[model samples]
Target: MRLLVVEDDRTLAGLLHKALTQEHHVVDVAHDGREGRELARSGVHDAVILDVMLPSMDGVEIAHQLRAEGIVTPILMLTARDGLPDRLRGFDAGVDDYLSKPFAFEELLARLRAITRRGAPVEDECLVVGNLVLDRRAHEVTRAGRPIDLSLKEYALLEYLMRNPGQALSRTLILERVWEYSFDSFANVVDATIRRLRKAVDEGYEQPLIQTVRGVGYKIKAQ
Candidate 1:
């Protein structure tokens, strides 16, 4: 499962990122509310770990807007406010669960699992970008009706890109999502895999979909 952690405290966010990655979930971190809302709205993540009292917008408002827009992705809010009114407000805004701060990591993990099990979002099995098609259920890739064979890493990279088409994904983010290691030394692995994936998906095609975003990373878009 891919989880989004929307937290302002960098230390806690990093801790959550590390622990969740170790638990085998691809994690994305956003320090501000606006960015968190944007990522949560992407519909690419299995769940979100949201923090209340965020800049630009609060977690409750974010949940309200997403629910109003008809996004059913599960949200687990982390907040220090544990009053009955606060809890009711959170529920009214459509948060799946709430965890007060200074709580146990074990409890957080448990609650996250529980909510996700009950409210898992249903998504389309096929991921499409232009002529490229990736069938998640079949675990197959095709472009313009031509079959394309990919290694495990290549397929994951492609799926991640296709899941967030038109968005620049940094090398660090890609490494975190596609590979187990989040260290900087493994950044080159992403570049090497991208090259191989590019060869497989775009070499023979006109109007290639894979794009190199200078000084940032890569994005996939329909030509």
Candidate 2:
């Protein structure tokens, strides 16, 4: 799962990032509430870890705005405040779970798992396209029962493509979504990456799953 961590304490944020990454989760860190909000709006992360106190906007207000915008990403709030009123406010603002600071990291991980299970129950952990199968939980891919080895970027690219099976994704869109940032659209990075991905996913197969739209971008079609 991909997660966004909104924390101002650099040390704690780093520790959290490392811990989440160690669990095989992709994590994006934001030191301030504004950046956190923007990253949340990008619709990339599956969940968010928000701090109660932030520089630009407080975590509760951020949760309020996200709820107001109809963004349903699960949020796990980290707060120093344990008062009943404060906890109620967090619930009112749409936080899915709360963790008091100076708490055990294990407890944090457990809460995160609980919230994510509730957040993404609609999404399957395994994605299937024709004979190709990508296991989101195992980080494994197979075709026709044959295992396929993929690099980190290759796996991410393939997962994105499979998610939007028949849609033609623009180069800029792929870069932003898969690479997690913006770059010149004219750059051949997307093309090059797709080339490498095609070699891995379609090279020996009689039928190709990845297709390129002339003058546009790429798509994954079963037939």
Instruction: Point to the candidate with the largest lDDT.
Output: 2
Error of 1 at 214 (Å): 16
Model 1 alpha-carbon drift over 4 Å, by segment: 119-156, 161-191, 196-223
**TM-score for candidate 1, residues paired by index:** 0.64
Question: lDDT by residue for model 2 over 1-223, one digit each (tens)?
Answer: 7789999999999999898877777677889999889889976577899999999999999999999999999999999999989999999999999999998989988888798788375457788999999887677899898898877678878988888889998888888777766776544888888889888889998999999988778999954
Q: Model 2, stretches more than 4 Å misplaced?
A: 119-123
1-223: candidate 1 lDDT, tens digit per residue: 6689999999999999999766655678889999898888877777899999899999999999999999898899999998999989999999999999998989998998798778333456578888899876466899999999987668878989998899999998887666745687888898899899999999977788889999899999854
Clashes of each: 0, 0
